[model samples]
Target chain A: MTMRSVGDGKAEFYELLPGREHVTVIEPRANPFRLDLRELWNYRDLVLLLVRRDFVAQYKQTILGPAWHIIQPLLTTLMFTIVFGKIARLPTDGLPPFLFYMAGTVIWTYFANVFTATTGTFAHNAHIFGKVYFPRLVMPLATLVSRLIAFAIQFAVFLGILAYFAVTDAAVQPNLWVLLTPVLLMMMAAIGLGGGLIVAAFTTRYRDLVVLVSFGVQLLMFATPIIYPLSSLPARWQFWASLNPIAPVVEAFRYAYLGQGTLSVGMLLLSALVVVLILSAGVVLFNTAERTFVDTV
Target chain B: MPRPVIRIENLSKYYRLGAIGSHTLREDVNRWAARLRGRPDPMPRTGAAEPETREGGGIWALKNLDLEVGAGEILGIIGPNGAGKSTLLKVLSRITAPTEGRVTMRGRVGSLLEVGTGFHPELTGRENIYLNGAILGMKTREVDRKLEAIVAFAETSQVLDTPVKRYSSGMTLRLAFAVAAHLEPEILIFDEVLAVGDRAFQDKCLDKIQDLARSGRTVLFVTHNMGPALDLCSRGIVLAAGQCAYDGTMNDAVRHYQGCAVGGRRQTR
Candidate 1:
């Protein structure tokens, strides 16, 4: 590498964005934190742009445009209401069946979408990965960002439905617990991204994991609180089910918005701890994997 | 003079070609169990030592290589395909790691291993320049300021707003090379990307590289074409069978490379 601080009008030609520095730490050796932070800051705008691309591409050429966001969950909620609520006679803890299932679906869809997309970071983008030198973590980060946008749109639809129900029915009252909604959302994103990192790290070495990841995520949805409320499960089963990381996230989400489900502070704290542990381990594994994955990938 | 911008010490990269699936796991486990029992790990068999020459099982992509590229020196790496030229660049660019060595780069390095790397098919050429530039570690404002020059250099100013997937192959290379070369990175590395476009475009790329070199940017040029390497490089390094066979002045290195090719032809005959 060479350094030329020439003043031949080259530097003057470009408008230096405020608060942005051309930071290149020429290290004697590679460091993890420095590399990741440098990449994140340098590519902040591109990250936003890629997120926009994912958001727009999903709607392009579709007749519904952004309405599909609401339509998808609405249709799924209706199907679950009929199939599980009426046919299977599944318990909904005395809460309205559509509201209960839609709440869980809203949380589960966000986690599942981010997880499935991020797990295939290596295999799906091998062509791009093979030729570029950016931080490998950027791809997964981009996936999380894009999924957040979709989740926001979907969540808006859920709110619109909830608001309609509140207006027509005297039993429903807008609750103050809605303020905790952002906290629940962060927990869901963390778990999804952390789990994705673990799967993506392993998939680089094992191609079988790629197919298994999709299947595994689908299987995990049943084990999670997606279809049934926590009160429906027996006491012993509830304890075990709550240990699943997604359980607390889903319950917290429902409790915050609908004010009808259970949210154990113990379980939520445990979920946060699990997310941190998984994210730390994933970062270590992903960093090590990034150093040598080009060969295997 | 300034310290060596790139210092490579005895770099080596080894690869294993095990049987399909996880067939080698059983033997690897057995070796681990043996080692636990105070015995040698016998799974390595014959190819474990000096792995570069093993035919059916493993091969080294680089071997015990020592090199130092000084700041502001334009060094060309010339070798035939599978001679580990790309692998070397991959290691240097931090896209891959060496098996048994370390490298210290003194400044920012940029590489264009292929035309249109990381170019989103759905993104317009203008957006792709920012995307690719950021992927190459350039800030958005830098790309914005150089936007016009990049489009002009690529000769696709009219199509800057058009999606890259709509562009021809020649146009793709034009836009990609323009963004990479004009990004003003401290070290610029090219891997045969100049082969894109017509003869005139190729010459234009060579001239651009020459200008970059004249401006005192360190460049590591990888190409099979000796003509361009000889014309642009102050020094040349030749690799053969995963090892550096020659490293000296361009004239001497080119002669050595030619001699090896003739010798290889004779051996084949």
Candidate 2:
């Protein structure tokens, strides 16, 4: 905070007093991995406003408005139930097909919503990013929250279906692990955000990556145990499936809420490690990209 | 008489030519290697070399230039196209990082680089006011305090709830400017977008700038329009070829600017 004086006799010692003045230094290159949570906290109002804008603006002229959030996932669940359960004969591990698919749909839809929205961060918001300065992470983070709200709505609908199955069938088990729902949701967010951010960062320089993103995310969902339970996989292949971090999350979620999927603490820990790794890498890539993407983008 | 609010040292930014995807795999590896081994860049895009990883091929938006702005000074930056006028403002506001040098600024820096940035067409006038304010770094509490003033200044209180897409471009610009005007940062940076609205609104913007200076806040303004810029700025700096060409009183800088434009000589001091 050493400041240069104007060289007049009036220069005073109170110039650099704490809290009275704040200083910012912009350099050509910086440690791109530095995560400034304090600055993000200071701009929390902006995050809330951005989330509100995204949520409220999209439904402005629509007839059904927010109901679309629930409808889209419900229809997707119906499609999955028909195609995967009825046509493909995928096993649902004794739980009802509709309930099983809806369980996975609520969480995966949240993931896809956050992922696809943030994957265009640099391209879509280049104008705002070029003109003003805020922690660029705020854009994607706000998308996560807004989509989380949509997920909440969809989850409530899923619960209604769960309640139907819980009374009619004794197979649906509500276990103590259900209490870990918040933690599971957070893990999924990290995966979506991390994967999205990495793609977004690359898309700034090579926009072709944008084309690959949605396709890749679709492939990712199928690779997970969404359409088919992890138990359906053979012994050798189950270990391979464990490599996909989201597999354990979907399985754990099913085990907690529906009471019938295998989840070892070791498997969960491995997946958590993968999620953290992806998220950190994404943040680092984002830090570097945000600083100079305006120029290249 | 007061401490300088902004201090820039050897500030320079180099942009790659046809910059997208120009970093061939070999070039990237070379750059990464150079950075890791503490060696200079394998290729120098501009003739000037950087301390770390010099760029491969690009133009320097700003060069080895140093400047200082004292507290409460309305320093005008006047330059031609590609003369680093907007680049300077972008660097000052932290919109983009410099490639060679650094800038340190005291107190909050709010930029009106472009008004109506991040304005959702689907959002109403009132909603956009809050959204744009937050985008420009105003806290919700601050925007709340100034909501009435903003509505009055923009004169769109009647259609506050109507979506902005329905508003005329002029009305939209007014609302955006109104929100930007109330940012009240310790330091303000702006581009010449103030010429957007009618003459009356232009005068209001100028008056608001003057009021900001009178309130002891620093202002950094960039404009291609010399007449209005001369009227508003107390001091002026003319830039050419990414370097400062002249720094003096507003009137003198405009004169020197004309001379430099005609002769194209390096008369920096």
Candidate 3:
């Protein structure tokens, strides 16, 4: 039908027919945590494109390219080895000191990178977010995926060092628990994503949280069993350490690959519960914040 | 009668005056407490009140807006600055939520609120096409199909592989516009993007918008250039002081806008 005049002298109007799909109604979100899985699935390609953009844009104009990914973690591990393992005389629970720190650093770097990137989702992306409309979660989700690519590269460097120690040193041995590496990585991602989303949501209105997050993450690293094994702590302290969701994942990762740290099903379950709670809460808050964050951010 | 592609009912958007929102947690809590105590909000009103009546406080960017667009209607939105044109588009595109009321759309909406919206300077033009296309909700395959047309329309074939940072402002705008033009959504919203580029490119954009309308896709266009608005749109809406001042045929709306611009009395519908 084309535009035409009606008998009433007003423009002819039309009513929607029933059963035609593709209707989109814009209203206030009824449920804050209601995830539009279909929308996210439809935007999967955008997610991949953003992942590519993040990965490429990060190293553009850099001298070393993706080598910087490996170099960053390697350098950090070196400093930790010198300060914590060498000078401070920290014990690695009989495992090789270099390998011990390497394992922790690689996993922690992945978590920290993902957490930091996701935390900046609103502030860092205010430009794009202001001018366009995409599922806001895509930005943070893409950050997580892109950081995983960097993590993969760094993990390979860690594996190379682990391999060197496995061959050259008699004390270094990886058990079947090494197979739980994927699970450990997933936990790290969940915790980072959840924690970052919570912080990102808060930073939308209260920007002071952004500064807090930057330093808070660094301080949090010390509290986790990253530089020290959980076994080295007293029994009472170990129980408290396990309460930190990241502690078990880090401990399990080391216990899996290096076979040095303590691993308990009960602690793993508790960590999983914390992950679920944080992630659900974060998603709810993030979804709510994203709706109106452009105005505030 | 054709069905309306879009319907907006009593939409209102209230924005705080100076700051974005609550500046601190303490302030937010105080505001929340005020709401609980059933007291008036402490924020000042800060939007265009009435055509010549100036008041300062928290402004309602859009207030009690009710509108509808029939499928295939190329509706032009003409308004002065601070008239809520962009705010209406933002609400229609779902970029921002309305403080009151609701909007319903019968199809997917593609908005080009600004050119080069998500274009990264470091990315090559070709890469940005895919990235911008995806950001506009186009599938990769869709972008693939339109890649040749987009490059030709933009006339950036030579610099397709070069980073966007090196491109001139005109070239970047053309490329960004080309990608947006090819999005092929059922409903399209554009806000002053044609203000860029040379005259020839502006003509091409108007022609493209006309083509999109002829193909039965609805379009909500916001622009200050009344010539194009009258030339391209069958229907026009004039927004004044965050409210719809005139809604009629393009000719009448242009007259109403001209009258308003010239300090004549507003003719409200």
In candidate 3, what are the lDDT values of residues B1-269, reduced to their tens digit? 35777878888887766655537776767778888999966652234243243335467888899998888999999988999999999888778877788777766789999899889999999999999999999989999999999999999999999999999999999999999999988899998888878999989988998999999999998988766546889899999878999999888998989888877444332
Query: Residue A221: error of model 2 in Å?
Result: 1.3
Comparing candidate 1 with candidate 2, which one achieves the higher DockQ?
Answer: 2
Candidates in order, TM-scores: namely 0.88, 0.91, 0.91
Clashes of 1: 0
lDDT of 2 by residue, A50-125 (tens): 8898888888879999999889998999999999999998999988999899999888888888889889989889
Look at candidate 2 and tell me the lDDT of residue A261.
85
Docking class of 1: acceptable
Clash pairs (backbone) in predicted model 1: none
Q: Which stretches of candidate 1 lie over 4 Å from their true place?
A: A1-35, A170-174, B1-3, B19-57
Q: What DockQ values do the models have?
A: 0.29, 0.53, 0.50
Candidate 2 C-alpha lDDT tens digits along B87-132? 9999888888888887878788889888799999998898899989
Model 2 lDDT at residue A195: 86
How high is the CA lDDT of each candidate model?
0.77, 0.85, 0.85
